[model samples]
Target: MAKTKNPTLYLTELDVTRLEGIASRAGTAELDEMLDALLERAAIVTPDQIPKDVITMNSRVICALEGDAEPREWTLAYPDDADLAAGKLSVLSPIGQALLGARAGKTVDYRLPNGTAQRVTIVEIVFQPEASGQFTL
Candidate 1:
């Protein structure tokens, strides 16, 4: 049997440049490595070149997580803007990392706080800033 290939990760040039700076000052090897892994594999492109379906920074998406009966809306945000109550997920978070470059209908794997694996299905991309021409946000 052929092994399944994961979806390609796409990142805007702007986001990648900024992420590089963040990774440098992450203060922990784990966090730095996580960001590095994502960056290394991503196909970086200009903001206008990114597909609308791709999740960029500040994109709002509806997610259906395994074991959760109701789908929830989450906006991927930087750490400063993260608010679990409002569903503003931080990119530094494990789940957020999983969803970063995944497209709608893709099921992504992330580690739960307890260190167990969990899957999150991206049900829909409600809004992507770059898709709507709101680049640089």
Candidate 2:
């Protein structure tokens, strides 16, 4: 295995269980590849590390279509449920993976279906529910 900075998986309990369900439904190898890649790249950002308004894990992500108006907001989920929702997407998905731990008003580059690349700016982030009261990083 290649060396990486953050090795521990940082998924929520719900995420873990959801991934298990996906593995059962679709098999482990596929999901394993995604998990491996995510773990290798994820920075494991704490609340303090995140910027003032960034959208992060468990935040609602609003995505604007490239050409059309009317941005769509989605409740980011893990594994396949996210895989199914239109605006909501799997953290393993290209854009979702990029948006993880990102704060609001930040822009990120990610690949699209046609092999084209695009930059997206974060407009809003509704923080994780647990982050409301506990202000510790």
Candidate 3:
């Protein structure tokens, strides 16, 4: 896949530290690559520096998939916390990785399991843990 210029991703120091450990222990090359990509393009920041509108771990967001009229709500989370039925999306998942650090009103492009390119727009960030001063979450 060709690398495309993406908007700068913002991540908290705590999140980065945890995700780096997860990435290092990842069993799949795809997961490692996804984490690398995210880290490569990320602008690491302190929890207090994170913007309120940016999507962070445990943040509930509303997004519209490309070509889809209806917006879907999801919570960006860790692999162990992922529960599709509950709308918790794993950061290792394509859509989850794509939404990381994205601010409301931004759009991100990602690849599907079938290798199809798809885009999604962040319509709103309903809940951001850091934004709410819940940095430990």
Candidate topping TM-score: 1
> What TM-score does candidate 3 get on C-alpha atoms?
0.89
lDDT (Cα, tens digit) per residue for candidate 3, span 22-114: 877776787677777787878788898888988999999999998997999999999999999999999878898889888899999999899
Off by over 4 Å in 1: 1-7
Q: Please state the error at residue 5 of candidate 3 in Å.
A: 14
Q: Which runs of model 2 end up more than 4 angstroms from their true locations?
A: 1-37, 45-54, 83-87, 133-137
Best of the two (1, 2) by TM-score: 1
RMSD of 3: 4.3
lDDT of 2 by residue, 77-100 (tens): 665456444656776677776676
| Top candidate (lDDT) | 3
lDDT tens string, model 1, 10-63?
A: 888888777777777767898778887886667777899888888888999999
Clashing pairs in 3: none
What is candidate 1's TM-score against the reference?
A: 0.90
Ranking by TM-score: 1, 3, 2
What lDDT is obtained when candidate 1 is compared to the true structure?
Answer: 0.85
Summing lDDT over every window of 10 consecutive residues in candidate 1, give the lowest-scoring window.
Answer: 1-10
List the lowest-lDDT window of 10 residues for candidate 2.
7-16
Candidate 3 deviant stretches above 4 angstroms: 1-7
